[model samples]
Target chain A: MNKIFFFLGKGGVGKTTLSASLAYYLREKNKTVYWASIDPAHNIYDLLSLPASPKVQKIEAGLWVEEIDVDRYLRRFLEHIQEKAQKVYQYLQILNLDKMFKVIKYTPAMEEYACLYALKEVFKKHEDKDYLIIDTPPTGLMLRIFSLPFVTELWLKELRHWREEILKRRQIVAHIKHVDFGPGAQLEFSKDKVFNELNAQQKDMQYLKDVFTNPKKTFLILVINPDKLSLLEGKRIVETLNKFGIPIKIVLLNKTGHSMELKELNFFNDLPQKKIPLFEGPFPKQVLLKIASLWVEDAYL
Target chain B: MVLKQIKDFLSQFGQGFKEASIDQIQRELEEMENAFALLICGSLSGMPAPPAFLSLCLLPYMERELKIMFSKTIFLDDKLAVWSDLVEL
Candidate 1:
């Protein structure tokens, strides 16, 4: 399994820049790196000065970059839903669900779930890569995504239990009738479509939850500025992660000016903090490369 | 004639048991399905729902239960929607 690294922070706090630098640093160590961003703003491509494309483009020999297009991702996801629905309920073909899905685009939490689905797709698609660097959405949205797997797993477990009960009842009826309730049983619930779907979903959710909570396999790197507001947001994220039991590998403090003293930040006192000095102009490859070199030397947690 | 009378009596008794158990089982299954629907798509029923995307993902499996959930009306005494049905729809 690949080691997953997530760059999380408040907006405009240099997450994309740091992600790019980290990816470069990892690639320099001869590791195959896949750097993907789900940020709607597509700042990763801008940071790399690469032309935007939906497909993964190779930035260097071992480094690949891609911006996940959530619209395309959601469309495919809906298509998958439609296909499964039509297969399970043959009458679904007449429902015009394709048009109905257009309305789902505006639903709450759709984007975040879609992003999660897309991230899973990306990881599955590039299984050969050794390292995966993710530049996630802004802090608020990112935290919501972090909390999603646990909530979804809980729901899946409850659903699976109900499905199992229904199947047990069907089995009991089959026993009373002394009928071979194969796929051709009167209720045909032994080969239950719903039960099968719930079973598959349960397994998928379990795997995702394991992936998220495993510290050795996943690292959530929180990025913050030296300012008060950014540190406060970072503190909130750390608290949330701590609640979720997600390991905080490192807290990156970006854009620290010469005058700011790291010793004064009490909130980050318990966590391992890495401070990146504020730069003069727009972040260029050379500047990012220099930071990448320094990062390798600093022994990132 | 005596044997036939005894056989008919036993068949009727067996039929009653079968029908009663089937009814009980159907009711239990329906209740379980309804609770499952509420858990999955509670937003439509006015509860705090999870992600809509997840609900949609589970929609294919819940087609029948979803039908029941949407069709059932909350009566005034139903406690589920305590304030609802106060005004005529």
Candidate 2:
């Protein structure tokens, strides 16, 4: 099993910085680590001072980084649909099937589904890597991404009904044309392959859900700046995650001044979790190393 | 056509409602309608409909409408207007 770590919180709470630092720290331990950002409003490249690309550029001896190319993922998903449609069309002598494929490729939840597909691919291919750290999007979209399995399952049920109706219509059309309907003709109309693929994808999602919900395999660190609004938002995040049965292992109080006392931390009394104090500063490599040391101590010890 | 789509969408929920208490179904439909209204009004007003807004806009309307009828209400977003089959959903 691969060790997956997600650094998530509201925007501008040093998630990217923390994720980058962790990746660096893990690399120093001679562990293979890949750090990627999934936020649309990305600054991982800027933070790392690297160009935007899909290739995992070597940041250090054991550390690698990449930003997810959503457009590339979308294109690949569309290509997969086109390829499947072409296979059917070549065998069945059907023309203009690309239009339907295009429509399906652009449906609601399609982009999210494509992203999930990419995740599955990443998990499979990067099994050799010791750690996979992801800097996710802001709370709302991140929640949607994590809860995608439930939404996709609901949509799949409706789609299965739609597929059956399409099959019935196709059968009627075949009858009217006086075509010789042979065995396995129903396979053309049956989106069972697609459904099966979706099921497989769901399994991958379940794996992630397990990783997210499991305390040992995964750790969710909610990063927050020391401010009233940010603290309230952090509280809401914890509450919402609890409602959805997501286990929040740690709360990261980022950008705090030296005046704050860790012993006097009463803001998160409701949460039965550890609060790690990360002081605010220029955030140099040494500072990040200090943060990583804290993380290793908190997580491992 | 829009009306037909609304009717179709309602019918899907109707099947689910068979197992649900009448009050629960009515409340759920009203909640759905409220969500729809908020999406429309917020989008029109150039404001993003946050999660709290969904609950705030829909919950009261649902509670009030549960007293009237078991009718399911549907609102179409402008973005979904192009889908011919969506009218039935």
Q: Which ten residues in a row have the lowest lDDT in candidate 1 chain A?
A: A179-188
Interface RMSD of each: 3.9, 18.2
For candidate 1, give the docking quality class from DockQ.
Answer: acceptable
Per-residue C-alpha lDDT of model 2 across residues A153-209, encoded as one tens digit per residue: 454454345445534544444544444323333425434343344345446656666
Candidate 1's TM-score reads 0.85
Name the lDDT value of residue A87 in candidate 1.
74
lDDT at A31 for candidate 1?
90
Q: What is the lDDT of residue A89 in candidate 2?
A: 41
Score residue B71 of candidate 1 by CA lDDT.
49
TM-score of chain B of each: 0.67, 0.29
Model 2 ranges with Cα > 4 A deviation: A86-108, A154-184, A187-195, A258-267, A270-284, B1-89
- Candidate 1 deviates by what RMSD? 5.5
Model 2, A22: alpha-carbon shift in Å? 1.7
